[model samples]
Target: MRGADCASDHELVRAKIKISLKANYKSNKKHRKFNTNKLRDSSITNKYQQTLERHVGNLEQVGKSSIEGIWEIYKNAYMKAGKEILGCKEKADRPWITLDTKTKIKERRAIKTELIKTRNPIKRKEI
Candidate 1:
């Protein structure tokens, strides 16, 4: 077998094997990301605080509740308040490569293919 483009005394080895890979599936659940930028506004902040306080006050009457139960009340209150006041942020799917980047990548690939076609080392270097 032929080695790679790098300068090395090592020869490439070929192997034949059967390998099975499991297909990975993405989850259907949407991520809960609150619009924290809304919190910067004084009015929004005040509303969130008021809503959270009201929810917490209402849930605080669980008699002889465990520490975990109390923590759950606090968590649920905050989540509900944030969801009502701030709301979840929308997911923006932007392209991974820009137009300029794609053009540059095409230019590089063309140059590489030209270099590969050249038999002379000097011509490859010039390319």
Candidate 2:
């Protein structure tokens, strides 16, 4: 009787081990499918990114000449003002002027020129 009982307990343990192994295999298969789906989605997104980048490049090329013309106009204006106010002899290239500094200089010079012109008339009238 004791030996039969032992044999039944051994069979129960084997059955439980088999159940656990099947559960583990099912989980691994689900994980593999999820990873494959993520890889497919990432590849699709990369293709879209490449397509958008190509479109942007095409648009930039179409506008290139007009952008250059505008830059030249701004450059000439800056050089003219610099020569008038600061006694700068060299022509200013657009890339050479730091915009914020140039703007501050322009504002300061405008104020100074206006004040000088206004004060000069007052001094002449007094004389």
**Top candidate by TM-score:** 1
TM-score per candidate, chains pooled: 0.65, 0.19
What TM-score quantifies how close candidate 1 is to the native fold? Answer: 0.65
Q: What C-alpha lDDT values do all the predictions have?
A: 0.82, 0.47
Which consecutive 10 residues in model 2 have the weakest lDDT in total? 30-39
lDDT of 1 by residue, 1-84 (tens): 653533344668899999999999999987699999999999989999999898888544855689898889888898899889
- lDDT for model 2 comes to 0.47
Highest lDDT against the true fold, candidate: 1
